[model samples]
Target chain A: MASLKDRIGVIKLNQKVAKDIYKMVLQFDDMPDDIKGGQFAHVKLNDKSHILRRPFCICDYDISAKTITLCYAVVGDGTKVLSSYEVGEKLQVMLPLGNGFTPDKNVKKVVLLGGGMGSAVLPAIPTSNPELEYYTYLGFANKEKVVLEEEMAKVSKQLTVATDDGSYGKKGFVTNILAEDMAKLKPDVVFCCGPEVMYKALKKALEPFDVPIIVSLEARMGCGIGACLVCNCKVKRAGEEETYVRVCVEGPVMKLSEVVL
Target chain B: MSNLKVNIAGVEFKNPIITASGTFGFGREYDRFYNIEELGGICTKGLTIKPKLGNPPPRIAESYGGMLNSVGLQNPGVDHYLQKDDLYLAKRDVVVIANVAGSTLDDYIAIAEKINGSKSDMVELNISCPNVKEGGMAFGVLPQSVERVTSAVKKACPNKPIITKLSPNVACIADNAKAAEAGGADAISLINTLSGMAVNYKTRKPILFNNNGGMSGPCVKPVALKMVWDCYNAVKIPIIGLGGITSYTDVLEFMICGARAVQVGTYNFNNPYGARDIAKDLATYVEENNMDINDLVGTLILNK
Candidate 1:
């Protein structure tokens, strides 16, 4: 079973990786064996004043070392508070949450796409499914906002990084870059995580391709275990009325076609 | 003489800690963390006459010490709950209270009558759902409306005890409690989420998609305890106190302030094992003290 109970994780490393972004690796006493990529960890800061626990994608994990890394941006008071914590300080973290990305048995080749902080979700996919071949494309606003390019490259068969401005690699959206390369790459399936806007763009851009597109969604969550219906996203499949599914339960990852953008 | 049990409206609970409605969804989600049977009782997610789709995305937002949510009471209609979760909860060792909601009096009666045939031990009326009748006022806001709905549902589901869950967004919460009692309600639960909102200064927009949401967490405990005391003094029926209860001491505070029992809400979001852990802590405290937990009810020593 997944680790459903809260576990204390001592901060092993907490440092800035990019502008407004900090990557913190938490060392736990032990963890469950079945943690998959695309799953998230709900983190509670030390003080009880901040009642809601912030949900962060399990960017990567080292089961042998009993550590899960969380990559987050200083968006508000909760994250700013998270950034100030020092090494050896502990946070209450519930890991291996939500239904993670699990491709079909026959699937072999894969395409990984990330946009900025969403790239944090890509590295763990390869760690979980090391047998599958991966081609990666990453997008960021500019050089200052880019993150996890190096981490993603290690897991991908081939990697492409682009920034909106000419300040970095390519000078346009990564989705457009991937669209240009779709026929040549010809991967079995595509997995992406980015802002909601990116999902819409990817849906339209990849409409020509026959490949299945899966995307991870982010929502303001309460009770990341699905008890509280706070983290809901709408999904509409063929011949079905639109229904809200808990991002914390049915998914943080869902098929792009099914998610009502 | 260690007794952690409490009786509310003739329903005997194993303990005084019931997971609040809307927080515990038919006891399925939290059961994965710990055996939910360990808690005293569970007020299930609010059920409507038909399945409610609720509000759009971004239904939740965070504050300094609390959170705001505009879930719009999205639930798989009463028939769905009866067909699915009711069977699952029937086997649990815990007391199951089916929380029902509706947009009108007919809706409340129809849903209550449906739940009366189910396996739930009690019914909690979540009158916080906005009503279209009477100038779009919520059923829980006005004392007259509280009594009207409570009595109708009480008669409709005569087999089950009725707990009119009051909204704290109203004036004179005590009068509402009295209204529930007058409507022949067996018990009353107070106070539901306080009406509030969280905003974004830069965008000049509200964080929730619904533009407004209900606030709950550790911050609302003071407001909840005061209301519980007010209602306890005003009504003869049992009162189930809730709001931002995070610890066993918070449970004790509710009981001392005249709550027959207390419910743990938002803290369940913080720790999945929160409600069960609190029940365990309360048991240990009572065991160590060798006292009956019920003795603490209405024992607050108010200074002159």
Candidate 2:
């Protein structure tokens, strides 16, 4: 449930973490039980001029601090407003929207694949419980496009990096690395989030793998609720029939087999 | 204080401000943000006899001043609504207006029968949606069919106030309004979203999956006002004006142009508190000008 009054929560700009990414931490006084990964928040900028709330995915949350971080790219008019705020400046944000990834307890090994901006959210799952053996595979166009390598390295058991231009670790692609290491490491589950092109490539490459796979899709959402069926994904349900369910409600995360890329 | 009450075909409202159909979904979402009882009324989502999955992806596209939507009347069906939706809206204090759509005459009759026995305040017969392929445009575009459907629904739901929502896409809105009136409609709501399309320049393809969608928001204001005025002159019953109403200024413009009341639609996307804001502004405007808000009704002056 969401409302215009609760459309934005008072937030304080904590720090400027990286280029194009600001870490605005909000005080969740009576925060909802769980702010799951892959779920998003709608932040309103400029109480008067802009009426619509802009959507963003949660980067990290600290219960002790009563704060959650939103890492965003400065792309459009809304982001321009978000980028102009200063430290300690009061901001408004709606929280923990959409569905998050379902982490399995029985899994022994985990592989998290992210490309470019998608890397912002990968740290949460690994840092939540450090006992699990986690590996990260990061895909970037070149060295300049890479982000959060050090932060990703801190949580995962091993960090594997790849760039298309061979400006970093592996010269080829993450899919090639995934193909090579599919047997020895034998990850029980694969969680991937990235651009459409990268996800499409992974969709084809990971078809034969026996492990359960989950994909986080990105679509232009209007309401960020079930009412506006704008953010819909074609899903192949059981019985070989296909139908569309809202990405904002049913998921931003679903089983790879259930979705049509 | 200025007699905010309004009764259309016997269904009385505390005020004249209402959350338009498709904009406010059965009052649950909007209720979470504010007290829904403050408003005059609400129109539930367009209902059909059977569950409709709606159109495909890219169902909505952002235009310069507004948006184009082709969300093909997606709903859980009339039976489910009567069985479950009534319980949700029953607790709310505002007048309930059920907007019903259909693919056939029987579909309309079945939904009307459901509304006949329900707690809904008014039955707004929506034969005006331009996005759907079937009964939406078919029943609305032709005056003969409009009269037929309105008559049929009036017969089915004898007790309910029947407000036939008119499409702006038709040749003459005034003639169509008269047709609804002749067919036994107690009231009328004008200017449903205008049919329009947006093209993706780079891809040389339409932005929406349906190729065309209903244009709404600030862009359609003038067109809506004209239709409201046109229909106002031709009909004796109250006209519920709608189309691209974002601000109180727009609401005033509609009232002055001869609308008894108005519905706020696409503006809900940009501002969820749009209806309340408009209500406040309208009250202020009425007070500042020292003119009766009701007197603003049918004040349109047509130049020959």
Candidate 3:
């Protein structure tokens, strides 16, 4: 029942964090308490050409400063326009959107797996709940694409960085390390956000572990809410056939088993 | 507070702001954001005889100042609306406008007849959905076809007021509006999303699953306003204007150009409380200007 709030957030900082990726810090007057890991902010671009607001996962939040950090890559015209924005420029943003990851109090150990920019949501898990033990596996296309190692390390007890081209940290996919270390880590719950292919592979690798896995999905959203019915993915419900649900509302975060992908 | 009320074809609305069909769903989705009753009316999604799964994935594609959608009339059908949705909508304080679409003439008649005596305040015939492969935009393009479909729906739902939603994809939108008015339409609402397509250079294909989709958003406002003005001068029936209406100023512009009421379409996606915000701002504008809401309708000055 949480409604979306449109607030003018000033760009406190907008700088390149890694190759093609720029980290932006938006300072708002009143920050809602419900914003959690995996929830995104629908940011409106100042340029008239980009009509739809682009969705970016919340990378971190500074409660005292009332600021939320977003790490996004310049993939298209919208993101390209966002990158050129100067500090102190006001941008329209709809926030605390979609359901975030549900951190179980009973679960003691957690493993957060992120592929590429999917790592954006990792720090929020630990920052929000300091009591819970956290381990993170971050995957990047190469060494140049890696970002936010220090911030993620501050929240996570242990962090592993992997690259596809053997250019940085461990030379393989993040799932490669998770598959080999799952028995030893003994994580009670696993959360992931990444490309569809990575999700399929991770789901298969964790099939034998008997651990519950949740995934954050990405889609080309029209409304970024349930109204447009554009960001739909087929999901399977208990005792019901597979049906399409909006990723923007039903979740950008959902159980891996519930989703067909 | 200023009086923002307006009557369209005998059905009175609290304000001139109605949520466009397809964009507002059944009013449940946006109810969490704002009170549904605060707006003039709620236009339900286009209903068909049977539940439709709609098009495949990539149903939406972003365009300049707008977006394109190929969602082909996906709904739970009219029976579901009558049994379950009616009570939910009836208990609400707002006017409910049932927007119905069909694949054939019989399909339109069947749906209209079923909704005749229901809780619906009015029925908006959507013969102009461009995404559907069959019977949708085809029935809306030509004046003869528009008249035929509108008259048939009128016969089926004699008790309920009928608004024929016109498409802008045709040669002349004003001609189609005249056709609907000639066919005994109680009112006319237009223009539906302009038929458009977006391309992916790398994929060498269209972005939407249906290849071509209907475009709606801020970019379509001028085109929609011009058409509404043309239709207003052409027909005597009330015209409910829509298409890329995002702000209260746009609402006033449409009214000045001769729209009795305006429906907020793509803006609902941009801001969930868009219509509510516009409704509030409109009242402020009316009070500040010390002008009656009705005085603004059809007050556009023609350049000599």
Task: List the pairs of residues colliding in candidate 3.
Answer: none
lDDT of 1 at A188: 93
* Chain A superposition TM-score per model: 0.98, 0.88, 0.97
Candidates sorted on TM-score, descending: 1, 3, 2
**lDDT for each residue of candidate 2 in B165-246, tens digit (9 for 90 to 100):** 9998888888899999999999999888889998977789998999999888777888988888888778899999988787
Write down the lDDT that model 3 would get.
0.89
**Alpha carbon lDDT at B36, candidate 3:** 92
Better of 1 and 3 by TM-score: 1
Indicate the docking level reached by candidate 2: acceptable
User: Can you tell me the CAPRI class of model 3?
Assistant: medium
Off by over 4 Å in 3: A1-4, B1-3
Error of 3 at A74 (Å): 1.1
Per-model TM values vs. the true structure: 0.97, 0.87, 0.94
Q: Could you tell which candidate, 2 or 3, scores higher by TM-score? A: 3
TM of chain B, each:
0.97, 0.96, 0.98
Question: What is candidate 3's lDDT per residue for B23-76, written digit by digit as tens?
Answer: 988998788777899999999999998887788778988888898998888788
Candidate 3 lDDT for residue A30: 76
Residue range with the least summed lDDT across 10 consecutive positions in model 3 chain B: B265-274
Give the B-chain TM-score of model 1.
0.97
lDDT by residue for model 1 (B1-304), tens: 7999899888899998899988888887788788888999999999988888888868888876788888888888999999999999989888899999887789888998999999999999988643222211378888999899899999999999999898888889999999999998999998888778788999999988888888889998899999999998999899999999988999999999999898998899888888999999999999999999989999999999
lDDT tens per residue, model 3, A132-243: 8888899999999999888878878789999999899999989978989999999999988889999998988888899999889988886676777778888989999777
